[model samples]
Target: MISTGEEVLHGDITDTNAAWLSRLFFEQGYALSRRTTVGDQLDGLAREIEHCSLTADIVVVNGGLGPTSDDLTAQAAAMAANTGLELSEHWVAEMEAKYARMGREMPETNLKQALLPQGAEILDNPVGTACGFVMRINRAIVLFTPGVPSEFKIMVQDQVLPYLKALFPSVVSQVCQRLYTFGLSESGISQTLSSLVVPEGVVIGYRSALPFIEVKVFAPQNCPNVSAFYRTIIEMLGDNVVGIGQPMLSEISGLLQENAMTVSVIEEFTGGALVNELHRDEACASLLKDGRFARDFAKTDKDLASLAEAHRRETNADVVLVVGGKRHEAVSVALAGKGAVWVQQVASKRQYSQSSYRTVIATLALDMLRRYLCGMPVFGHYESLSSLSSFSNERRTG
Candidate 1:
C-alpha cells in the first residue's frame, strides 16, 4: 500500500499535485489504503506519518519542507521515527555554497533542510529550493517530496514514485471504458441490451433522464479483447451511444447546434432542463425564439382552454416541450418526461379541445401545434417521452 499525507494552511499552496500522485499510484495497481490531511501541527504530522508508514508499504508525504517556520514535515518525520535530526555535513555545506555562488547568502532557515535521519538517504531535488528524501520504517518506505505542485510533480516523477515502484510488486495493467447513451433509463437501457452480448469482462450501468442515459464499463487493465468488448457494446447500443466523456444531453445539444436547428419548450416538471440543455451553446440562443411555459397541475377544462389561448397569443412559440420532476416521484429518480410540442400554426387551425386536467389540455393544445414543428405522433400519458422526435402517434384522438 502507498499512503500519502499533506498539511494544508489557508493561503500558502494548493495540494492538487498530491492528489494526482495518488491517482498515479492507483492506476499502477498499488493499494492506496489511506489518505489523510493535517494542519501544520507537529504532533498531528508525527502521528499521521507514523501511522501511514507502519500501515502501508510506502508512505509518501508532501509539503512542509520549506524555509518557513510552518514547514514542519522534516521535523515531524524525524519525531515519528523517534530519531534526532542531524545536519548533513556535505549537504549543508553544498546548499550554502550554491546560494553564495548565486551572489546571495542563503537564508539561515534553509540550512534546516540539510538535516537527515540517521538511516534516511537524501532524494536529490534538481528543480527547486527544497530536497526530498526516503526512509524505511518497520519495513515500509516513506518518501517525502516538496509541497509546491510543479516541484512536487518533478520530484515524484523523477525520484519518489519510481523508488517506491521499484520496492513494490508489479501489478497487472487494467482498462475500462465509460459508454454514454441517450433516450433511456438505467433499467430501460439495461433491458434494451438484455439480449445483447456484452462479454463477461465488460459490464454495463445506466443513469437516466427522459432524453439521455449513460452506460459505463469497467475491466482489468490490458484485458485482451477489451477493445472488441467496447466495440460490441457500442454496436449493440448504436445511436443510443452519446459518445464518451460528455453526457447524452450535452451531445444532443451539440448535434442541434451542428445541424442549425432551434428548439423551444413548454415548461413543466423538468423546469427548463431541456431548454437549458438545448441552449448549452451560446450560439444556440440566436436560433431559439421563445419557450411557452405553463408549469403546474392546477388546470381544469376551462383553465386549459384559457391557458392554451393565452399561450398562443403570447409566445408565438414554434415548439413547446414539458420536462422534469424530482427523482423517486417517477419511474427512475432522474426519469424526467417530455410531452408534446405545440406550434403556432396548429393553434390557429381552430379544432383543438380542452381536457379536465389542465396539464393534459395544455399538452393537447401543444400537440396540435407540434405537427408543424415536430411530426412525432401521439402523446399518451403512461408512455415516456425520452427523445425529441421519437414517439409515433397515428391515433389523433386524445
Candidate 2:
C-alpha cells in the first residue's frame, strides 16, 4: 500500500516505492495481491483499512504517520475498526523524555502518535520518529507503516514482515525459479511445462515479452530430495534459464565486464528503459558504447550506420542494440571486432492485457542477451556456437 498525505503528496515516490516493495515481497515469499493509494483523508483511509482487513492475510499500509495534523493514518485506522484511540501513557513519557534530552519541549500533538487501538502493537523505529502500528481485524493482520521510505523500510524489515510471516507459517516452502527464453511464445512455454509432472507442488507461469517462464514450487521444507530436484529442473531446462535468484540485468553486464568487454545502446521506441537496463550497473558501465536516443535518430538527418560505427570505434564497444517500433525485431549490429549478436522481438499488443507486459518483455530480452553473451548457440533460435567467435567477422551490421 502507498498513500499521498495532503501536504506531502508526490507522484514519483509512489511508483518507485511500489516497485521496491513488490520486489521485497517477492524476496520474502509473500503472496501480495493488492496495492492501493489514496489522498490523505481520514475517512478514506479508514474505509481502505476496513476493506483490506476483510480479505488479505496481511495488509501493509504505508503513509500518513507523522506528527502533523494531516498525518492521520493511526487515528483513521482506529476509526475504521470502530475502535477508540487515546495516548499511551508509557509512550508519551518515553517520547517527552527523548525530546527533553534534545533540549526541546515535545510538541503536544506528538502525543497523537502514541495513540493506538486497544489491541494494536507498536512497531519500534530506530531511525525516525514515526512509529508504525499493527493489529488484527476481521481475522486479518494489518501492519501500518510510515510513508517516509527510510523509516518504513526499517520498521518493516526489522519488525512487521517478520511478525506477519509468523502468523501464517508456510507449511510448504515456496521455492521459485525464473527461466528466461527467447524465440518462444507463451503457448510454447505452456507446451513445455504441461508434460513435466516432475513435482506436485510445482506450478509454472508463462510470462511473455520479458519472454521467460517461471517455475514456482511449494515443496515441503523437510523434503529430503529438494536439492536433487532443483538440480534436475535446472539441467532439464538447459541454458534457457539465464540467471537465478533475483532477476538481474546486471548479471549479463557484469559477465561482459569480467571479460573486459563493452556494449552500446540505440533507442528507437523503448524510450530509456533499455538504456537504463544497460547502464544500471558500474560493471555494465564498462559495456557503455555511445548511445543514441530516439530524438537523435528522428530529429537529425544522421547516417545511422556510420554514426553507430563511429561510436563503436570511439568507445571500443562490441554489441549495439537497436530498439525500433513494436512487433519489429530489435537487431544487434555487432561491430567488426566487438560484442556478440543479441536480439529481441518486441510487440505492442499489451494495451489490452490483464498481466505484466513489461516484466514479460524485459525478462525475456535479458535472458537471451545473457545466453548469447555466455557463448551458447541458443537452441530455440539458431545453431549453437561460441557467441564471441560467431561475431568475429560480423562487420558493423545487424
* Superposed Cα deviation of residue 230, candidate 2 (Å): 5.3
Residue pairs in clash, model 2: 209-360, 209-361, 210-360, 210-361, 210-363, 210-364, 263-287, 318-339, 377-384
In model 1, the Cα lDDT at residue 205 comes to: 50
User: How many clashes show up in model 2?
Assistant: 9
Clashes of each: 16, 9
User: Lowest-lDDT window of 10 residues in candidate 1?
Assistant: 328-337
Residue 289 displacement in candidate 1 (angstroms): 24
Index of the highest-lDDT prediction: 2
> Where is the poorest 10-residue window by lDDT in model 2?
382-391
Best of the candidates, TM-score: 2
Clashes of 1: 16
Per-residue lDDT tens digits for candidate 1, residues 1-398, read 22223334443455576568755665556637777677778898888888787777767887778877777888888998899888877777777777877899888888888776777788877666678888887657888888778888888778866676676546543354666654335676667667876556554555444334656565667667667766777887654455566654444445545555554555554344445545655654565666544445323323333343344345554333433222222211111112322222111112212221223223333333222223333332222332222222223323
